[model samples]
Target: MNLLHANDQAGAYPPSYYAATRTPLAEFPALQGQIQADVCIVGGGYTGLSAALHLAEKGYDVVLLEAHKLAFGASGRNGGQVGSGQRQDQDWIEKALGREVAHKLWDLAEESKALVKNLIQNHQIPVTFHPGIAHACWTDVQVRDSHVYAEKLHRDYGYTHLETLDRVAIQNLIGSKVYKGGEIDRDAGHLHPLNYALGLAAAAAKAGTRLHERSEVIRIDHGATPVVHTATGKVVAKQLILACNGYLGNLAPNVAAKVMPINNFILATEPLGDRAKDILSQPIAVADTKFVVNYWRLSEDNRLLFGGGESYGYRFPDIIKTTSKPMLEVYPQLKGTKIDYAWGGTLAITMNRMPCFTRPYPNTLSASGYSGHGVAMATLAGKILAEATAAQSERFDLMASLPQQRFPGGAALRWPLLVLAMTWYGMRDRLGI
Candidate 1:
């Protein structure tokens, strides 16, 4: 089953809290007949929209095609934490890619966070970025490791936004007795993801990008000049960008080999009112140390937007049942709270947990496998893609240079292999080992 349609209807966003509260963008017409452009971007999520916007701003004719609505996939459905660093921590990057490259990646990550803020400010996107992301640790060892990592970031990278939190401090802040200790990154923040995506779409369109919704890409003819075909129409362009992320399917066999798609679920509670303070004393986001991380934050209306649970299949599991168990574990007092909305989204991940950026063909570029840290990075990726298209390829090449490996098994068997590995990790999380 195509993940895009396996769990959702055609041309409709999931019934997520984000979709319920989105800042609406008027629908673009589906692609018809044939069109020509300088760049043809597949997938209208953050990467595609950002690339279109940046390219259009640089006087390049762009066409962006979306299978459903813009931001209709993980981009709109995810927990909105604009996290610090790449999906892997600085220590991991340093160990694997050396300190020099790690430092450059760190700087790029910093720029990504800034880019998101600047886009919101410059575009006047109707979203508020409340700062702070608390890392709630369940074990003392984990807490100590986190503190050390925070120090490493400060000493080596000159990052100073982290504040260590003791057990009492964390319990007081999160109103949860389970966490032993953790740290808070004051620079990291959260926002309404769907609204931000819609705002980007609006900006891209205003910058002269031709966007087509419900125009799913069916085939691509790759060469010096690439042709992307949809059911209703085709796009002939000087360059092609594959920004499909979790919904990429078999469109590009090489990218599909290294990037695997997994499903994650989230649930939003009814407005907590005064009880909001009981869950989070401050307006910030929190992600715990679980292998399948539990992330949450308060909505502007005071609702708890909690995300957890994972499945490897194309179809989503019972979202409320799968997510609420973990939600209640963190906040047992919320056991009886009304769940206002529940949804699931697919996000892609690479073997080493870093994003996969590559030139599958000389004239074709593809970026996906953001792991869980796509919000800011995906936005930056758009600008980099635009830069590459403009023959200013330093940044894009730097990202593509990161080492990547295919899943242990090929596409046909990767799913089973991942399920086995995730099951083992989930067991470790349960055993608290």
Candidate 2:
């Protein structure tokens, strides 16, 4: 079964807390006839919308296609933490590609966060973008490493926003004894992901991006000029962008080989009132060092938005119980808290846990496999794609030069291989090794 249509209805958004709270947006018409544009973008999430807005601002005629509604996938449903740095730690990048390239990558990451803030301000998006993200540690080794990494960021990268917190400090901040230690990055923050996505769509539309909802891309024919086809229409463009991420099924075999999709679940508790403050004294999001990281923050209405479960298969598990079981472990006091909403979304991951930027064909480009740190990186990617299409490609080439390792097996057997690998890591997490 196609993962895109597996959990959600065609052209419908998932019943996520994000959707329930999102600001309403007028729906766009689906593509029903042949269309032409300078740039044809697939998938209308953060990446596609950002690209459309940036390109449209540059006077490029752009057409963006979404199989479902705007912000319907992971872009809208994820933990809204605008994280710091690249998905992999800077030390890892330094080790793999040396210091010079690592520094460039770090600069790009800093630009990513700044761009998000600028968009929210310039476009006047109504999303509540707050400050602080606490990275909690469960084991003492993790605690030691967390501090070491924090120090490296300061010494090596000149980043000074992170403050290390001891066990007592973390407990006081998060109201949880499970955390041994952690660090809070004041620069990184959280927001209402869906509203932010919708705001981007509105900005793109105003900038003259022709957006078509419910227009799923069935195939892409590459040449000097490419044709993107839907069931009822097609778009002929000089350049094509594949920004589908997890929802990119068999449409592009080259991308599917490297970027594998996985399902994650999130649940929101009923308005916790004063109880919410007791859980998180500071209004910062918290993500622990679990193999399946437990990320959570508070809603504007004082509800606890928690996300923790993972599924290798296409189907979602008992969303409430699976996520609540781990959540209760973190904050057992919330054992009886009413779960107001629960939802799941699919996101793509590369073998090296970094983004996969590929030039699959001469005129076709693709960006995906952001792992879990897509909120900022994906947005940056769209701008980079737009710049590259306009013949300015220094930054895009830097990212594409990063190694993108594919899964060991081919498309047919990759899922089974990933299951075995992720199973071993998950077990190690439980064993605290």
Candidate 3:
């Protein structure tokens, strides 16, 4: 089954809270006839939109095609936590690749956050960006390790935005007794993901990108001039960028091997009014130390936007029951709270959890497998892709150097292997191993 049309309707956005609250923009027409451009981007998510906007600013003709509306995929349907560092922490990167490379990666990560804020401010995007993300811990071992990492970041990295929180302090801040301890990164923040993505689309169009909605790429004839075939039209360009992330099916087999798609679910509670303060004393986003993480934050309308559920298959589970189970575990007081909305989204992941930035062929580059830290990283990747196209390759080369392993089992068996591995990890998470 085609995952692009698996759960959602064709040419429509999911019935998500983001869709309801987002400021709507005029939709672009579907591709028809033939088109040519300096660059043809196959996906219209953050990475594609970013590249489109940046390449347009550099005076390159850009064409961006989306299967649905702009930001209709994971770009609009994420936890919205703009995290710091790579998906794998700096320490892990340091162990895998040396300290020098790790430091370079850290600098690039910081640049990603700055690029996002600059875009929002410069373009006047209505998405309200906030600061502070608390990493809640379940065990004393996890708590102590977090404290040590905070100090290392400050001392070694010259970063001092993180504050270590004891158990009592964490409870006071989050209004939850489940957490043993935690640390808050004042540098990290959250925002309405869908609005932010739409803002990028508007900005890219204004900068001269020809964006076509409902223009799904059926295949790409890769060569000196790659021809991207949509249902009704085709785009032949000097360079091609594959930024589909989770929705990237078998279009590019080389990328599909390294990046596996997985589904995650979320739900939003009805307006909590004064009770919202009881769940989160502060307005920061909270993510706990679980293999399958539980992330949540209060929406601007005072609703608890909680995300936690797992599905290896293309389909999502029953929305309410699948998500509510984890939300109640964190805030049992919300047992009877009504869920106003629920949705599911797919994201790409690699074996090492670092993003997969690779050039599958000449004049063709693909950036995906961000895992869950796509908010900042994916947006920044667009800039890197644009730069590489413009013949500036420093930043893009640094990211492409990171290791990304292919799935052990090929096409037929990859999905089964991933399901088995995830089940084992989920069991360990429940056993607190």
Candidate 4:
């Protein structure tokens, strides 16, 4: 089943809390007939939108096509945390790809966060960057490791925005007794994800990008001049960018080989009012240390927006049931709190949990498999795509040079294999091992 149409209606955003509270953008017309541009971007999420904005600002004739509404995928539905580093931490990156590459990647990650902030500030996007993300740990070993990692980031990377938190401190901050200890990254933060995407789309459009909603890319004729075909229209462009992420479908099988799509769910509780302080005292986001990580933060109106639960399938499970169990496990005080909205989204993940950046064809560039750390990286990926299209490819080449491996099984069997692996990992999480 095509994940774009598997669980949601055609040309409609999911019934997510983000959708309910989104700062609406006037819809762009769907593509018709044929068009030509310097760059054709597929998937109108963070990467594509950001790419369009940067490319258009650089005076490139850009056209962006979305299967549905902009930010209709994981970009809009995620936990909204602008995380500090890449999906994998520095130690893992250093061990896998040397210290120099790790340091460069660290600098790029820092630039990504700065880019997001700059975009919001420059465009005056109707979103607030609430700073601070707590790394809530369930085990003492994990807490120790987290503290050590925080120190490494400071000592080696010159990042000193992290504050160590013991069990008592964590419990007091998050109002949760489940966590043993952790650390808070004051540099990292959260925001209204969908609004941010909409702001990017608006900025891109204003920069002279031709954006087409409901313009799902069905095929691509790759060569010197790539042709992106939608159902009713096509874009012939000098360069093509595939930023589709999890909803990529079979557009490019080479990318599909390395990036596996998975389903995740999130729910928003009714406004907590005074009880909001009981949930999070300082309005910071919290992500726990679990194999299938649980992340949450408060909405502007004080509702708990918690995200968890994962399934390696096209169809979504009962989101409220799937997500509420984990949320309650972390904060049982919200046992009977009314769940105002529940929704599921598809996000791509790679074998090593690092993003997969590839040049599927000489004229085509693709970036996906952010593995849940896309809020900032995906935005940066767009800017990099713009730079590469503009003949400045140093950063793009560096990201593409990162070690990316295909799934153990090919696309046909990868889902089943992931299911088995995730089942085992989930069991271990329950067993606290």
Candidate 5:
């Protein structure tokens, strides 16, 4: 479905607390006539804005186009979990790539955490970035796996930021006995997502970047200097960055084929004052060890932001209960918490559970396939894409070198295959297998 209309069709961004608390800002004019820039970005989410901000800061004339307003995609409506690492675990990555490259990716992952903080500090984006994140396990075996993974990261990559909190510790943290045990990383945190998106857009404009909202790119013609065409006008540019991601639609065919758009949703509960402490010993964003992961965090005002259910199709789930029910399983203490607002966003996932950065055409860059781990990595992708545009293509090349497999069932069949796979995974999660 057209995500924006789908969102608003269901009263997506109702008078939620975030909307009430969001920063006031000016809107940019949509693309209307022919123009030129050093680079043109086709989406206004994190990756696109990051590229525009960085490139414009470097004195390159940059223009970014978004079919809807800024923060209209997953960038604004996600769980706000600014997590570390790829969607795949370190062991999974090491097995797919090599030890050395895996270590480098680990380094980048750590850098990704720092990069978010750096941007917030540099741009003064006040998004209530929470302190750290925790991973809870439903079973003893999952807890053991968490321990093993924690040890592996420290031993192999010399990274030691997380503390393995046992069942008792988990009990103390979340004030819950639902989880067997877990690990907590003070580095990975959650934030006010919409505020961050808006802040980044403001910074990009300040850096001499031109941003146009409700401006969709219909066609892109490639050459030494590419030309991007909208309905009423066109932009002839030195380079093109296709950061549309899940919103790419048919702008690039292979992109949609390899990176299928999946819907993950979030719900906000009425603010709880002292009762919020009853939910956790310490506040932190959380995801479980289950395949159909249950992720939750707290808003600055103490409202619980929970996200769990996922759909492979274009449409958002019709039932809000279907999405927030997972929250009860994770923290039964929240059983009585009143759910206020529930919204959905489309995020692209590659088959291999890894991001893909490739040049579909020379000078025409395509960076998508972030799976569910986009917050930090997408921002990093933008900088690397800008680097490539500036002739420093090594980092971007490293990301592009990571093995990417086409979605299992081609374009038409991929969604069905994903839904099938997710059903099995969801069943496993339900059975606690």
Candidate 6:
């Protein structure tokens, strides 16, 4: 019943396949008194931590505050799929912002993936980086469009890597007949998101970023220099970057309005073992081309980590079974597969499916709303913000140029609007519309 403490996810990470098998030693302290830094970042997820690491590497004294532990939010509890591109496709993206800017943005998505790869390798973060991710579709036309997307991406953008899979090829690859077909992006891949966050936090700390756990930012006073006031202490920073994403809350009404939070739920099945072959043809992340995307990938121990559906409120929807029913439709034999763990995390989406990157005040900046594609994008966003702070502002300027609007209602009424929108999408999923 606490206004802020989401207790449901406390034991939420209990000895899950992720906790038991992966993750390294965690080491961040709680703030005891007032402190100051060059940059004070809010939110301990990928965006904040990534920025902390970049700034720390630049030897700028940095301090990062997290309401909960690092990765305790959406970053920790995601589907673990590192998807390519922005929320929308390059075609739509180009159409939205014209061809030239779209080309630069699409190029950034590719760079985002490489940035993650380089960070993991440089830090030696022991995360599983496998090749290939496929999008499953229900009809032939959808399959054709998937192929055409790949062809057009290559033909127009000089970008090539997406391979089209036919119905038979998809069946052979997915071990599921539910999908008519889809496309596989060999360059795009998956990883343990929580583990990755933790790894970045460790590296950030090692590189001299002061990470304060359980230090919740209550308010911010913006000016030529900025200050972040927390429960027990405050940070007097020369500049600020709000990387909190969907959880931005009342920190900045403008940010909260432009970025609407939606809950995304994920479930891990009991170890599939021999039955693992019954799902993925190869050990790769799989996403279905549905309005509510069904994204699934295997864990280190071979458990199927499946995620889909959205709830438009603060409460994690009581609909994991409802959202995952379609997985049964795809692989019917696994009816009693025993969901070892099920939980939901919140992710933000923008009206245009574009991220919001801007300065709310003179020295206080905010960047969020990559939607579900935060793993790599958020990390890259951190770097962009750091570069902007360093005075090389082109990247940040390009990102800031993307137009995004807040939900019609404020946070209080935003939920109802989301409820209405999601209800329509849920109905579509049910009706196959």
User: For model 4, which pairs clash?
Assistant: none
Model 4 per-residue lDDT at 394: 96
lDDT of 3 by residue, 1-433 (tens): 6789889999888888999999889999999989899999989899999999999999999999999999989999998999999999988989999999999999999999998999999999989888999999999999999999999999999999999999999999888888899899999999999999999999999999999999998988989999999999999899999999988898888888999888888899899999989888989999999888999999999999999966668788897898898888889999898888999988889989999888898889889999999999999999999999999999889889887789998989989999999899989888888
lDDT of 2 by residue, 1-433 (tens): 6987888888887888888888989999999999899999999989999999999999999999999898788999999999999999998999999999999999999999999999999999988789999999999889999999999999999999999999999999999999899899999999999999999999999999999999988888889999999999999999999999999888788888989999899999999998888899999999999988999999989899999965668898889988998899899999888898999999989999989998998698889999999999999999999999999999899999999877888987999998988888888877888
TM-score of each: 0.99, 0.99, 0.99, 0.99, 0.95, 0.96
**What is the per-residue lDDT of model 4 for residues 344-393, given as tens digits with 9 covering 90 to 100?**
99999998998888899969999999999999999999999889889899
- Relative to the true structure, candidate 4 has a C-alpha RMSD (angstroms) of 0.8
Candidate 6 residue-wise lDDT, 377-425, digit = tens: 9999999988888888999999998887778877567668778987898
TM-score of candidate 6 versus the correct structure, residues matched by position: 0.96
Cα distance off (Å), candidate 4, residue 138: 0.5
Worst 10 residues of 4 by lDDT: 309-318
Error of 3 at 25 (Å): 0.4
Clashing pairs in 1: none
Q: Each prediction's Cα RMSD?
A: 0.8, 0.8, 0.8, 0.8, 1.9, 1.8
Q: Could you tell me the TM-score of candidate 4?
A: 0.99
* lDDT assessment of candidate 1: 0.93
**What lDDT would each prediction earn against the true structure?**
0.93, 0.92, 0.92, 0.93, 0.82, 0.82
Residue-by-residue lDDT tens digits, candidate 5, 311-354: 65676665367676777766677777787887777778887978
Task: Pick out the ten consecutive residues of candidate 6 with the lowest summed lDDT.
Answer: 7-16
- What overall lDDT, based on C-alpha atoms, would model 4 receive against the true structure? 0.93
- Whose lDDT is higher: candidate 2's or candidate 5's? 2
lDDT of 5: 0.82
